[model samples]
Target chain A: MNRFIILLLIICSVLPVFAADFWLTQILSRSIILGVMALSLTFLTAYLGVVSFAQVTLAGIAGYTIAYFSANTAGIGAELPWVFAVLLALFFSTIAGALVGLIARQSVGIYSIMITLAISMAFFYFTRQNYSVFNGWTGFSGISAPSVMGLDLGAPVVFYYVCLFTGALATLFVVKFSSSPLGLSIQGVRDAARRVRAIGIPTSPVIVSAYAFSGLIAGMAGILNVWHQERVSSFSVGLGPTIDVLIISVIGGMRHPLGAFIGAITYVMIDTFAIDLISRDRFNTVIGLVLLLIVIAAPEGILGILKSVKERIKKIVLN
Target chain B: MKFFFIVFFNGLTLAALYFIAACGFTLIFGLMRTVNMAHGALLLLGAYVGYEVVEITGLWTVGIIAGGLTSAIVGAAIQAYILGRYQGDELRQTLITIAISIIMADLMLWAWGGLTYQISLPEMLLGGVRLPILNVGYSSVRLTLMAMAAVTGILLWLLIAKTKLGIIIRAGVDDREMLQALGFETKKIFVIVFAIGGMLTGMAGVITGSALSIAPGTDMQFLLSSLVVVIVGGMGSIGGAALGALLIGMAEQYGLAYAPTYGVVFTFVIMIAVLAIRPQGLLGRSEK
Candidate 1:
């Protein structure tokens, strides 16, 4: 797994040298950002045994924070330093996620789905309805990427590398944290909450911490996403994007964090190239069918399918 | 004082609509354990079909029947064919239904376009009526809707309490394996529950189409409302659904009227508060 990530990083690092500007900005950067967001859902689902529809809501909270604090086309912008804006965004989003976790701490499976779904939709409606802070439905525009240190993130290649590095760091954090004592406890909670409680370790804090960590990851992606679009709106956190994250996580294989990137790249590929096979208007139909097929045929997603194929090939060769 | 009466009546109308849409959702969840995430799409499909039928036949009653039947068949087919394949795995079933909803929403948008459709009201249902005591004018359709919701609640109650299907459902809710051991066709029972739920959703769709308007995004709106209602009350309990609907519907209308901007927040607060206080909901039975 380590070797595979190293190889993947090597390829990604060199992509800007060979790939077109369009590919760097639109395809790769976008995929990395979406992958990071889906990683949040993947982490919770895999570790906490909780499926959160509010992951994007957490992301949007950060995105909106950046929009409100940073310079904006809308007059409502506070025009804070980009660094401050990003920090505050992360802080607010993490809190929002923790709050969601607290409310839904006792729930799991279908019940968890309901609560998170409602919370996500409520945020969407709130953003659309509350004009003073969110600028109503128009949201904020003309928000450009900021220079970090000496690097101009406005450059296409720079932004691509930025997203790639963010994704890599996020992946490493998950990999490292899962082995930590707290992470093991979170996993234990997933396996059997009643047993964990029987051991006298309070389960709610672990669950809330997991959500907060994912919130931080999602918030990072959300900021990158806002930079990617150069705008944030109600559409960002709406049901469309909420479902998009779920589709990515499920498509990538819900259990693995790295699968999120694979899912995102595949999803973004379909999003961009499906127009070649069908009308642009029917894209949802195509994607929907893809998701439906994945759930029914390969619940384990692309990674699972690859594993099975490898096993079958090995069996045939041995025979 | 007069304005208060209008909002109160408005709240009733909204409650009635929510109750009609949610009872079916709770019914399916109560029996199948599947959340039917595509339920909103089903409701939207019913509204579109009803709109088309009313336009073609020029009969409101036919439109209602046609819409309800279409949703019933489709809902039943979804359960009997697709969802039934993943019995006991609630997560997979929910995921599959979400996919279905996405496909259904896109296809409906293609077929119905993005236009806001309002099923025209019949001649007798038109105009306003004076309410007693308050003597304030209110829409007759809303009154009819309230009456219809009450009737629906009673009919559903009877269906659950009186019919053989009800007995199977009650039995299934308490113990599915036992029901199967008793020689019941569990899959058939599931299909029946989905059909009834779909019918309620369809008829509610038509009613909502006439009362307000139906558009592409209405599905998500109603779906979220149903989720909140079912959560706020109790899952799988009819009385809970009604109570939840009343609370959420009244909260929604009152919020919109009193606090123009933070109305969503008000409804959101109620859900959070209820979840915090009673995770099982107001009338929901706590699970072991």
Candidate 2:
């Protein structure tokens, strides 16, 4: 299975070169960024059993950080080096994630959802209302990716490769971290926090660390997102995008990191194609129906359904 | 002092609307443990329906009733078909309701157009009433809303405190299993509660539509405000909902009046502070 996945990744990496469709490449890169964001959410939902509506807020935080530090079309540009900007973005997101984690630590289930929703809404309004920093609703634009190793990072193919590399790295990091002792303990806490506590593990720190790690992943996605779009807006971090990430995570199957990518791909494809078939106003209706059907019919998501199908086939063949 | 009174009156009026909208939400949450994210959409649908009814009949009261009934029916259908399947899975229910809300919102936009709609008021409630004490006039519509909310609060209290179905609902909230064990058809009781909750939300929607304006995105704003109210007041408690609404409404009015820039920020600050100090809420009991 691992070898097959690696082979598939290699094929996907090079296929963009042969296809060379600008729109397709853009969609793929956007999906990958969204996938990275969804993966961050999957980490919390899968291991911690806590579904947050604030991952996009974290992503927005990083995006705004990059916007603030980078040379941009906006007059108020910091013009810092790309590396420092990214590092600063990651740092701020991590702190924000930790703070959110601490704030949400005590709440469980529905309360957690409400708290995160409240916080995200607050952030959205703050950014939208405060014109001085966020530049109001229009937000900052003209952000371009910096060049590295004599290659123009803003070029389509190069940017695609950058997104692919970053997405893969983030996924691998999640996979590796989930297997680590801390990750296992976090899962243990998810399953039985009291038992884990009795066994001498501090559950709160573990959960906070998970949130921070997820923040780092989301922060990377956020910076990449700004580079891809060449702008950052308050709308990107609003309730809509936050809900989009949740849908993507759930559609892909929150049980695994790969599910995030799969869900993002599906969502992007539907979003891209559905507009062609239906009126613009009715497009969300289609997406909503699809989401409803998926949640009701296949709660485990596309991957879960596929896995179950494979297992059934194996059982039937053996029998 | 007059400025303060004006702010206070505006706050109270807004609080009344919040209380009405949030009561059903809190009741549903208390009884079902499901956060109907579609509650906002339902309210929006009600407002749209009320707008249409008022447009046709030329009577705001008739429009309000029609809107409430329409939403009640839709709410019950959603509960029966979609939400009922996921009994205790709060997350799945939330997602499903979100999907429903999205669908409803889009449909509403497509049907009603994206323009904001305000329900036309009757002639009696059109003008402002002169308040001698504050030496200023207040909108009669807002005062009517406060009266309606108070009446709703009293009626709901009576229903819960005095009626047999209310006892069953209270028992169900306290312990679902025990209520089920008592041989009452708990499912039927839930349906009734959900329907009533939906009716209340719809009624509030029409009132809000008349007082303010109902647009495509207004549902989300209402949802957020009600969620804040519920969280601040303590989920599932009517009195708590009232208290939460008052605090939020006053804070919002005062903030808008004083700070102007950070008006909405004050409500969130209060929420965070309350959550940090008392995670259960101002009136909510700690969940076992």
Best candidate, DockQ-wise? Answer: 2
lDDT digits (tens) for residues B213-239 of candidate 2: 999888899899999999998988888
Q: Candidate 1 on A199-267: residue-level lDDT in tens? A: 999999999999898899899999999999999999999999999999999999976788899999999
lDDT of 2 at A260: 94
Candidate number of the best lDDT: 1
Q: Which stretches of candidate 2 lie over 4 Å from their true place?
A: none
DockQ for all models: 0.89, 0.90
Give the lowest summed-lDDT range of ten residues in model 1 chain B: B1-10
Per-residue lDDT for A1-319 in model 2, tens only? 5786698689878877676666535688889999999999999999898988989999999999899888877666577988999999999998899888988888777888899999989999988897777877888899989998788887888888888899889988988898999989989988999999999998889888988988999999999999988999889898789889988988889888889999999999888887788866677888889889889999889989989999999999999
Best by TM-score: 1
Interface RMSD of 2: 0.7
